[model samples]
Target: MKRSIALLALLLWLSTVALVHAQTLPSVKPEQVGLSSERLGRLVSMLRNDSEKGQIPGAILLVARQGKIALFESVGVLDPKSKAPMTKDAIFRIYSMSKPITSVAIMTLVEDGKIALGDPVAKYIPQVAEMQVGVEKPGADGKPTLELVAPRRPMSLQDLLRHTSGLTYGIFGNTLVKKQYLDAKLFVGDPTNAEFVDRLVKLPLASQPGTMWDYSHSTDVLGRIVEIVTNKSLYEFEKERILDPLGMKDTAFDVTDKAKQARIAEPFPNDVTIGTDTTFFDPRVPQRWQSGGGGMVGTVMDYARFCQMLLNGGTLDGKRILGPKTVAYMTADHLDGSVAPGPLYLPGVGFGFGLGFAVRREAGVANVQGSTGEFNWGGAGGTFFWVDPKEDLFVVYAMQSPKQRVYYRPVLKNMIYSAVVKPNGK
Candidate 1:
């Protein structure tokens, strides 16, 4: 009788916790969702095996299909040093994954008819009118030096959203202009978004606007723009408009609570430097520069809501953050002729740039398995999420091991697709 009483109490407590997750995906058996429970276990075992082998640190994976969660699990330690068990709510750097959130914020303004995609960015950030394209030519001597030239046309808000603004991340290129980002201190050590943009606006663009797809400070600039237009900080606008509406409780630029800080997933101490995602810059304290391109931290479930919102055509559970048409427009390929097949940042062959995602262009060319209409993005901190509208599926993977980031994204993709017993809502 005592054992039965204890078991009943435990079950009741679990139900209460489930009710607390306002945005939790409904729990459903894999078979009910047309997924093989046994096959899904294969993916879980691999995750455990990888963590046990020290191939990666802590990770959280969530797989939801048809609005029901089929898998959600955490594996490994929160930190190798602490050895505390990982949890589903662990915070992670999220890096470039910030782009999608920032992009969605931009769309919200667009839907309100507050910003026009074609408007010259210089109109708002006037210093941009003074910005010039960095041209390299054999000038005076043969040493390949930078020459300033006027852009064919001023960069517009559209250019910023699709990463065609010609703004280069200093770490990616070796040119003199790339070095300028370093010399200019475009990234803040302790500066406001306005102060950070002061340096960004002064740097010469790497190419003429709309002529190049350089993953860069463009979204960071957009964050500043959000502040200027909404009279709210990017952090504020994102929370009120995106995070809070989506019920992403633990996602933020700063993890204010000391207890939440304890849940931060960290890579091995000896992990190679990952630019701003380096453990050197802590997320516990509030940051002066809120990077829209990267820097936000979140959990697997928090991001799962964001991805599910996109999959559900811009609304979830009565909160309409964006119109279905706007969401569709943003996820469509914007790279048609703007970018060619050279070295690019996409995860696979059949992917192309959208407003804030890598939209899959073909079915068989991707490094992983997915439908052509799927869109996705990843963070330098080994976090990733993808929305497969065709399959009515979305998955989120959060981790902190930069070394295994490259390996696990495809691994999760392959495993998730293989475990699906039904496709295209059949």
Candidate 2:
């Protein structure tokens, strides 16, 4: 009886050590990890349903927990035009999702003492120091024209990160400032970063520096700031500082290889969006305009690696990109209650704007089910990812249907959370 008891105890000790020594991001069954295999099947089924109905062209979904991959799926088509199969390694246009990367790049520079969040925009971009804000006024031709007013304060790097700067995306609305953006073609085609910034400064501010939140060209401006401080193009700096270090080999400002061009994802032929038509970039040919805000093409596995790094507190596979405190600072809410709400996107109710992400202030604010401290951002194209630090979880979805993106982000967020089952029923 004593010998039998000792053998059982030894077996228990071996099991404990196996759990403790788990690898980071190792592919595992959902049940073996902390997720529900049955429920994960349900999540993938929804993707199939959406694709079958022609709601979404195609997508890639990845979920990681406790540093292990629980789910990775490739569904739908690679090219809607050609009906090619969507592979796990197919490239996608991760539009606004690029902002998070640019934001990280800025904070990495801050970590190096090369820059600070509180620095004035004019300090680096001189044209912004004395820029005037625009107020619409009635004109002699029965049309409204912009009347210039001095800004209450100078725009800062922090404001740019939070989208509180008086900038506007021409695609969002028909405001006079947006018209100015349209007039100048601030982000049109192959203009170099310098030319883009020069053309951008010629426009008037959409709002006071810190008064309102407009989803404008602020991130592209932030990208330019990164270029200015590093003395390298935004693409080059990103490759050295973040992408290469993280082993995100397939992520880049442009895909120049002839072979990779065949893997590029394409949107539907007609404009099916409600407000405005999106401009799709052709990766086969390179353009000089590197939109740090929206110009990036990457694979599903590559972006999942990026998300895992952020979930691991700025380190992934032994790489330390940003320190823990810096990640905390970047994801923390910068827009307190004092500032009026900006664009209503994530955490629909109890959420705030962070340096680089939309943070969840409470669990029940949004239509979806998620824990507090849940920060996420999505692309105009149907690509979204969320990191829940409380649960050590992050999920990434990549697709290319701009019109259906609005429907998919919340839908996927809710489905992924519903799939979670407590370990040992704890």
Candidate 3:
């Protein structure tokens, strides 16, 4: 009788503990996630006051947890000139955010044995075989000019993904290769694959393959490489492989539908002096360069679906876009000690360039409250996403700021961490 009573008491304690855990999940309605409703009103008021002072023209913010879209908020006007209010479903030009999706497309091909990480880029695009490295010199005008020289090593598909192939962005920072990339008009206009290939061959690399980390148009080059290997245009390959399977209905390189254009948010600059100039670039035009680096528009909820898919190990609902192992490979660190000679833009961060996104190995610099295994990537405009497996959490923030300063990672992460409970209901 004494032993029976002891066993029953132990079982009761375990049940009580589980019940408490369910109650302490930190889950709440969307409005409750931020400061209270009164505080949120204050936040909106502050945002408006700042906008009038030319701090920012408009903004949209959302926070979701465990598939529950608990908060969706917008402030200021979509267009300062037109005085249009931002909407929850506003579309934005998601620049480098497009890289992660394109990287997914490439990995799909990898899963099918269509390509390998170690494959030479020249194997698919012959013009790349003749590529050279740029050496700085002065022209007759005494201004800087680039001369073509042989590369120390060949650039591989893996090098392109990791930004170690010495291919520098012409606009990233002023350098000899930057001038050359601009002079060659590498990505300025629409061009056939053959034309793009010819221009890329003539351009010189900035460094030897696998030597350094520089954000360049390498993903854009990957777009062309995909066409060569798959024998299909970049859009066609992405559509059949990723978009259709994942049900990302609103995402595309160009906006052809009038209705869709109506919902596309105008890009805003973080600097009030510039604001948003609507008279600038038009997204409706079909261009020759489908930049894998920074070329695509997506809605807020649609992008959330993409994040959720990644959170679930490359599957959404019953559809699987990639193998779980592929997802792991893509998010793992590929950096070597010799690469990235400069201080990292993000402090206490070790680089992990999988197919596209950067994974955070060091937590202190990321200043993120998520798991050490978390990885994320954002756009030029104020768009961001981070996934934490330890917390089973995912967060995305979308804004169309031109200056690229609004979507802060640290503060936003702090807010999310405040709501995350320890596994045992601590």
Candidate 4:
């Protein structure tokens, strides 16, 4: 009896050990993956000091490489009033960071033959059918002005993905199209299918489709098209196609559970040189519009899974979401060597709008030292993410505060470069 009892006890011990091992992340050590915990700590300290100095409320960051997650850290209070310190599981308004995820979902549909990239958007969403373009201004004397007319070439799904669909943001500086968008009450409140289509259709194009690269509501329009193509709401399609498949349980368009709301970090305000006084976090409440462009909440781990899937050539844990070629095409710059004028935030950058994020220009220009063929983009808030194929690396950073004041990516790049394995792969 004593011998039997001892054997049972040993079995229990082994089970506990296995449970611990399973719960632990894959063995991607920081040093092995070329990361310095010391540098990471300093980065956290900087964020905390910034919060204490009233620069931001909080921040969260994660670093992963070679199918392993190394660092997941958070700094500052999730809620300043309650003083709840941020945790790894703390939720954040990912903002434009949601774009890439949504884009991935769209591409998954593409892989399934649900839609084609070059197919005219009007083929699915009738709203874009017969879409018009802007031309010359009317004369003050009510006579004909120099009318610049052109064929209304059908805007393709590729155009929507590339922001070449001639759509413009209503909030972007005061312009003629901006005025039209405002007057149409577009992007004013929680957008609906009919309301969004009506307002967007009435607004004239900023430029002819495929003629310019203007950062606009093309993603939101793409979201609507996804609904038409899939016969499911954008929210439903994302849940069915991407989130559930990847075990992204915490990510969603809306906070459905009360417990999740407690974890949802507050969106802090910042100095915005453009648009109205409205900030992302109105004292800890989520925004009304379930905007596809930038309206989802997620944790670092959840987002890392999405990025990891991309880094793994569109498969994670044997679940193939995109073809390897599709992943490569998405990361490759697609702007045909057309340089964006002015001091764009990403210097030496070229546009390659695929499913949702910007593809990197090349191994040259506007890249971190270790960023070889890396593709990345960020949110209006401090949230940023990148996938470095050359290193099989994935990274995500999040913070509350709706302004483009901080340049966190470069700092992160420097930190990453410090940890690159020596020539012999360390």
Candidate achieving the largest TM-score: 1
Q: Which regions of candidate 2 are displaced past 4 Å?
A: 1-24, 137-144, 271-275, 343-347, 423-426
lDDT per residue (tens digit) for residues 1-426 in model 3: 999999999999998885554222234674433324444345556556766776666666555566455556677767666778877667777778888888888888888998998998888877778888887889999987778788777889988887787787665556777766767766556776557667777778887778777777788878887887788888888888887666677778888898877776775533322222222245777776677777888777667778778878998767799888889888887876777643223223553555587777765654456667788887766678877765556777776665644445565666656644334112
Best-to-worst TM-score order:
1, 2, 4, 3
Root-mean-square deviation of Cα positions for candidate 2 versus the true structure, in angstroms: 7.4
Stronger candidate by TM-score (3 vs 4): 4
- lDDT score for candidate 3 against the true structure: 0.70
Model 3 C-alpha RMSD vs. true structure (Å) is 10.2
For model 2, the run of ten residues with the poorest summed lDDT: 17-26
Instruction: Please give the CA lDDT of all the candidate structures.
Output: 0.85, 0.82, 0.70, 0.70
Per lDDT, the best of the predicted structures is 1
Which structure is stronger by TM-score: 2 or 4?
2
The root-mean-square deviation over C-alpha atoms between each candidate and the true structure, in angstroms, is: 4.5, 7.4, 10.2, 4.3
Off by over 4 Å in 3: 1-54, 137-148, 268-280, 341-351, 367-369, 404-407, 421-426
Screening candidate 1 with a backbone cut-off below 3 angstroms (N, C-alpha, C), the clashing residue pairs are none
Compared with the true structure, what per-residue lDDT tens digits does model 2 show for residues 262-309?
A: 898877776335235456767777878788888888887777778888
TM-scores for every candidate against the unseen true structure: 0.93, 0.90, 0.82, 0.85
lDDT of 4 by residue, 1-426 (tens): 999999999999999885554333475567776666676667667777887886777878777776777777788888776888888788877777877877787788888898888898778767676556666577899754444344368888887777778777766656555566667767677667546766787667777777666777788877777777788778788888777766677787767677777887765433433354335633144444556776777887788888888888887666677899988877765555442332122323533544566666555565455454677777776678888787777778887666633466677667765655543134
What's model 2's lDDT at 313? 87
